[model samples]
Target: MLQPVPFPIRKECPPGACICERERLLDDPQGDTRILRLTSEEEKRLVARIDSISTYADLQHIEERMREQLGIDLRISPGMHEVRTVRGFNIQIVERPGLCRKTRQSIPAAIRRCLDKNPDIAYAILNAHDLLRDD
Candidate 1:
């Protein structure tokens, strides 16, 4: 089953300074990204697609694809137990019973660069909870 995640929309920014389209919320001034915990069904769906990955090269290809397609620099650590941003901000994706939450207010430099270059990509990742929400 897909659980509902609350997305509180903010709408209080000065004219020409609105971040609603950039962060999908007018209140997030620090650009913290939300982490969505995948449900069992969602996890299964993802695992099924990448289960055949048997080498580091395969994983790297997927990572490159994600960067190209989503504009988010995702890196799976060498330890293979953690995922992080290019600047090393840990990104944890957990199963049910673990609630989805936001990252720390400190935006990593890699993400900051992406935001500077293209706010749209930052917006897509920042408000991923809403875009990927099941319902």
Candidate 2:
């Protein structure tokens, strides 16, 4: 089932300054990029929610909500995930794609850099692609 995640209210910013996009070589291990400017709380909540997903298909629903509510510009790659059982316990493990942000050096850096710089502007980049689909 696809649940709707609320989109955080964004403060007004200059036109075309809300988000940024960058492209890397197709052969590069990392995929394309999308930088989203969010608040500290919003970033944490979003990441936590995504991390909580137990299935790739569920992540796809979140991605769809992001595009619908947030904007079509943002990209979300759910990638691959699996659920396993052990000792009557079920665990879901997912391989998250690379997420990063811009650095003072103008090079792409880890997402932590953005979180460290300004929690208010939770700038994050998400590698948007998928390896599976829902049946």
What clash count goes with each model?
0, 0
> Which residue pairs of candidate 1 clash?
none
TM-score of each: 0.28, 0.32
Best-fitting candidate, measured by TM-score? 2
lDDT of model 1, residue 47: 44
- Residue pairs in steric clash, candidate 2? none
Model 2 weakest lDDT span, ten residues long: 83-92
- The positional error of residue 131 in candidate 2, measured at the CA in angstroms, is 8.0
